[model samples]
Target: MTNFSGEVAALAAACLWAVASIVYGKLGARIPPLQLNLIKGIIAIAFFVFTILVTGELFPSITILPMCLILLSGVIGISLGDTAFFTTINTLGPRRALLMQTLTSPISAILGLIFLQEKLNTLAGCGILLTILGVAWVVSERTTDIGHISTAEFRRGIVFGLLTAAAGAVGAVLSRSAIANTQISPLWAALLRLSAGILILLVWASFRQQSTFRLSSLRNSKVIAGTLFAAFCGTYLGIWLQQTAIKFTSVGIASTLLQTSPIFVIPFAIWMGEKVSIRAILGVVISIAGIALLFYL
Candidate 1:
């Protein structure tokens, strides 16, 4: 149990990320993807400061190497990874894109084992297999006439989501690596990541020639609601819980549980009046199995 502290923190991070997914998911329903990402980061930045003030342990001594690592993780995970995911959700719907979590745990494990030289024994391998199989079960559509989405389009969305998950896994490992080397403070590291994510999007918006970002959009009621939730979950709560978990546990376990965003998204999707399918059910089951194996196996 003592050694499980890290695992416990990972679980907490997963739950928080799950909630953030819900927040951003709903926000996407109402707004453009760029606006959603932009405001989400802005809101998160505010709460991050609040968190620093509230927690006395917020200020850690800063250094260069760890800061660079965490910032890179942010670029990979928050910027590129999330951009792919949101696009997938828009293209494939949350039910389908979320199912991609099934692959993330195994990918993270393999990456960590390769790059970080973390252990990946038989049980871990078995856990990875079961989890993937379960996720496949959850999202596998049976009907030939499932309406609208052609097979090609469906596959495209899955591919995008998987890419997002893969990149995200790499980011998680990198963040963990930085934390392991106590050369930099986690707060500054997190700040770098958040700021970097925001900047990346800033450049993207400029590149795409998006019209002036509107204060009116920011003032929208739903955007405000979503922003608050985003701040709480993604910026303050999510990162805080994530660092705590990673600092305490293996990067593999932390990624495993955080990928459970799909699991939480399922019920939330239903509650939001989206149609639930048998395929989606199977995907959730697979993801849960994967998570269980990640911990218990």
Candidate 2:
């Protein structure tokens, strides 16, 4: 049971992210991507600090090296990666943006194999492949409302999307390295990473002369509620579970499971009266079969 804790945590994180993404999509139109990312980071950081204080966890004694790795992971993964993701969503729409994210699992797997020497067996490899295929298939489906974009903007979005995937993979592997080699609790790890990410965002916001906290945006109750809810589910709890998954499992398996968030979005789509196609259902089935292989074998 303990051995499977990482897998369970990863799946749970996916569910939370699925919920958050829907909220974020609605909020994104009203907020600039950088501002939205910073806002959520601040909110989530507040939650992390409160959690740490309540749990009396304080700061765990961690070596400077592991601490640095975690910080770097946050800078790359949350700051750069998430900002790029938001930009991609704005430029190419969410479906194409999410399609680019399917690259993370394989990239993480390869990185883990090279850097951490965390090789997957034949069965696990097949699972990873199938899961990636399923996710790619679902997100690549054509929609009636595809937005028009200039070729230059399309190219830029593609670049940012790839950057998002690469940064995510690198960040996951770095977090896994730090956590697997240290005694830091997952909660503390999350706090440290988010703190680093928020710091970078603050500096970037300052350099651009953009206000970090927009009281105007908060004036709207809907925006405030949505931001807080999304932050709690996606940034706070989602990252905590993500760190736990990295701590308990190989980066490859953890990343593969984390990438299942898109699959979880299908039920949400149906509940919202969005039509899902037979292709999407087939993708879900394939993804589930792959997930089962990861769990049972």
Candidate 3:
């Protein structure tokens, strides 16, 4: 078997997630983000369990400290960060929301330094910046009139976006802290984090007097198919690749590569019959250049 680098894994995860996002964009019109998150999470967990059983992999005995850290990472990253991102998308629209998403790379870099004492060299740091710049440029091409939103509402959306970025960064940093130098399998780590996130969402739903067990959407065959595909691409395989990337690379590099999802989104968008603009094409070129620099320069 050829040994693939962490960079390859991260890039693949980004591509899968980009496709998942395109699918979810159509479904988001009908389903609430929280409920969708829980549903997909449950489905993904089922697949994860099946993989574990088929592989005959025994669960590792993890200590409380690492377990707690990993669980917290999921709660912060998936539970809170994803929810906040959904809210931002609703408030600010996907374009602005995607612009805000670029913040995660730098925030992860900073958090990685503070928590893991990980430092990037000059070229790597430049690559991160160039990647972010490319993604931001591609995503900020919307002209939606936000005049209807009050000043306070606009500010609230900005705050939510910032929180989403910070939570995601902190969560990944925590995962690094918990699993660094450990014998934990990336698949198992992903399972634990996903379970933690789903548990947290269930608890929050209960507290809100909402039912997390609603299955009306499952009745529709198309919806079922879309959900399963999203779960497989976005949560199941996407997360496993994310864990593998984190295990083999610095969090900064992993995060910068992962944020290239926007670049991948461009090709998918064109496939979906959306018109591709010159600026978006330029952004893709810039992002590819940055990735090349990160790996080769």
Report the Cα lDDT for candidate 2.
0.80
Per-residue lDDT of 169 in model 3? 78
Candidate 2 lDDT over 27-87, as tens digits, reads 8788888898999998999998888788887678889999999999999999999999888
Measure candidate 1: CA RMSD: 3.4
lDDT of 1 by residue, 62-168 (tens): 57777788888988878777777776676566656667755766887777788779787787788788777766675566433234777787777778788877977
Q: What does candidate 3's lDDT look like per residue over 58-122, in tens digits?
A: 98878989999999999999989877877776666544454466667666666667767977678
Give lDDT for model 1. Answer: 0.70
Q: Ranking by lDDT, best first?
A: 2, 3, 1
**Which parts of model 1 are misplaced by more than 4 Å?**
1-8, 54-59, 113-119, 142-147, 150-152, 183-188, 212-216, 274-279, 291-297
Best by lDDT: 2
Worst 10 residues of 3 by lDDT: 138-147
TM-score of each: 0.82, 0.85, 0.82
TM-score winner between candidates 2 and 3:
2
TM-score of 2: 0.85
Which residue segments of model 3 deviate by more than 4 Å?
Answer: 89-99, 112-140, 144-159, 209-214, 250-252, 281-297
